[model samples]
Target: MGFDTFGDFPTTALEADQARRDAFVADAGGESIGVDQLHRVLAAKGIAGNVDLVAGDICETVPAWAAANPDVGIVLLHVDVDLYEPSLVVLEHLWPRLVPGGVLVLDDYGRWEGETRAFHEHFGDDPPPVERLPFVDATPVHVFKR
Candidate 1:
């Protein structure tokens, strides 16, 4: 399961590995999805394949989906595009879905204070048997493995 605020996508043009994704949906789906009015656009253009598109609060959705799919492996819980509360709520919910040895990666993690604090508190000096990998660059990312 994946979770995000849909504020903005990492890329544009919608090509290559993610080509199967709809450009409009990937870029602006969040706004439409959040409004609970994307079905028209989806049906008009055959965009249901990406039914993973959700229209609710991440905190509520992530854990619900995780609890239901105990067999799933490697669920990406991306929370960079939203406010701190929703992101934290969602992460708290999704954390349990990650099977032992699975990974949780955060994009633009080092750029925001709220996100950084949450990450640290959740996985402090001796975090739940997980390895921390912080990459530096224009868009730094943090990866935690359990």
Candidate 2:
């Protein structure tokens, strides 16, 4: 499952930077501008049925989804929310539901201060060791749930 607003950029930080959005659209070859584009891509890749793309604010959608599906255990969570409050909300609601040994990937970790701070604040003094993958523009970091 994935959560996104799926229209204009959601945060002020992202909205103020049109270049970043433009670059992403360009990088996607103009194929990822909206939810329909994502659906088409997933359909073409033959995995549309396997993925659930939820459209809404993460802070609202995540908790609502979790409440509706109480038994689900997330094995892998890829958080690319890019802002502090939403990132923290996602962690607070979902982290406990992540199964033991599950992996959490924080996209935009090193590149965005908000996300980086959210990661640190969410985990506090006992933050799990995260491994930064080389060769990724997003500078994503991942850690396994213990």
Top TM-score hit:
2
Report the Cα lDDT for candidate 2.
Answer: 0.74
How well is each residue in 1-146 modelled by candidate 2, as lDDT tens digits?
97887765454344423455456556764332577889899999999899888887787998999899999998998887667667888988888888888888887776666677778888889987577676666554565454
What overall lDDT goes with each candidate model? 0.54, 0.74
Alpha-carbon runs more than 4 Å astray in model 1: 2-51, 67-75, 128-137
**Candidate 1 residue-wise lDDT, 36-76, digit = tens:** 44546666788656656654556666667767877776545
Error of 2 at 17 (Å): 9.6
Cα-based TM-score, every candidate: 0.54, 0.80
Total residue pair clashes for candidate 1 = 1
